[model samples]
Target: MLYQIISFVLEVATSLFGGACLLRLYMQHQRVPFGNPVGRFVFALTDGLVLHLRRVVPSTGRWDMASLVGAYLLKLTQFGLLWLLAGGLAAVGWVPLLAVFGLVQMAISGLTGLLIVYAILSWTQAGSPLSAVIDRLCAPFLAPFRRILPLVGGIDLSPLVLLVVLQVAAMVLASLQQSMLR
Candidate 1:
């Protein structure tokens, strides 16, 4: 029970910090202004680690490599700590692989979350302050699906399609993780 609680807390912390780092990378890449509330929040949450990482992994204009590296390091730390906490690092070779897989899983989960919020805000508060931010964040992910899926009766189905794709990705990641155990 205590392990479960600790693991849950660790997961939440890593997810938010890692997710914010990734968001920082994406927003910078998209050239989205970081003056808004959403931008401020993500920066505040991620700056400590990202700034330190910036020394080693320099950003190249639109590409904020530091933020990306920071997020990956956070996932690596999370998986490493969890493995240690769970009693043993029996299979040391799997740590890096798990960390990489975890980072991919986190990215998928984060994008799914943004899409969910974007879809909800589109229905409830279409003109809200954060809606534009969410839309910009979600646009690239939704674009390819949008072109392929198109709208059904004026209702966009891309979000639904993206959600399904994310779910399938999650399942595949889980299977890969399980396979790594043996």
Candidate 2:
């Protein structure tokens, strides 16, 4: 029970931090002003690790290497926590199979983040401050898709296509994780 609680807490922390890092990367790519409330919120959430990582991970070209590394490290920490929880389960004489579950959870979180970014952009188009903030925060991820997809008949379908691709990738990752557990 204690291990489960700890794992859950850690997982949430990892996801939030990772999501914030991704958002920062998105903002940097979009050239958005980062002094607003939403930007401040994201920065506050991730500043600790990001500040430390910035010294070690230099930016290359247009990419924020620190944010990418931060996200990956967050995921790895979540994985490690889940692995520890699995061990705890084994100590309790239960079948320890949480690693795959953790991977699935992480994948779902990532997919949800993508969807959220899409939704925010959509809402921004409809004129909302929060949406605008989110749009700026997610611009990096959407830009490539937008360029590849373009607009059709005055409607943009990049988000839809990207969502589909993200979902499919999530499914594949989940399947692979499950197979590894087995």
Candidate 3:
């Protein structure tokens, strides 16, 4: 029970911090001002870690290395706590399949976050700074789809396509992880 609680808290922290870091980095890329309250809050929450990482991980071309590193580290920490919890379950003769399950859960969470951002961008017509940030963050993922789909009747379907793709990826990852556990 204690292990489960610890793992849950760790997962929440990792997701929130990592998501904020990613959003901030995307906003920077989109040239959105960080002077606003939302921007300031995100900066305050992640600046310390991102600033430290900036020295070691310089930006490569257009990519924000610090943000990627922060997200990866957050995922790693979440995975670690999950592994620990799985081990605890195994000790009690519970199913030893939880580690893989935890991984799938984390991946799904990440994909869901991306989808939410994409949805907000599409719905708001990219008006809000948050929407602009999301647009930038999702550009790499949506670029190919946009080229293929294009805008029909002035309605962009890229968001729909992207959401479907994300869902499929999440499902595939979950299936693969479950298979590994078996």
**Predicted model with the maximum TM-score:** 1
Model 2 TM-score is 0.68
RMSD of 3: 4.9
Ranking by TM-score: 1, 2, 3
Tens digits of per-residue lDDT for model 3, 51-160: 99999999877677797677667766666566666665444322334433544455556656776767766766667766665566577777898899978899878878
lDDT, ranked from best to worst? 1, 3, 2
Regions of candidate 3 where Cα sits further than 4 Å from its true position: 28-32, 36-38, 85-111, 114-129, 150-154, 180-182
Q: With candidate 2 superimposed using the best TM-score fit, by how many Å does residue 86's alpha carbon deviate from the native? A: 2.8
What's the CA RMSD for each of the models?
Answer: 1.4, 5.1, 4.9
Poorest stretch of ten by lDDT in candidate 1:
87-96
lDDT of 1 by residue, 91-127 (tens): 7667788888888999999999999999999999999
Model 2 agreement with the true structure over 120-167: per-residue lDDT tens digits? 668566476667676554565568998888689988777677777777
Task: Flag regions of model 1 displaced more than 4 Å.
Answer: none
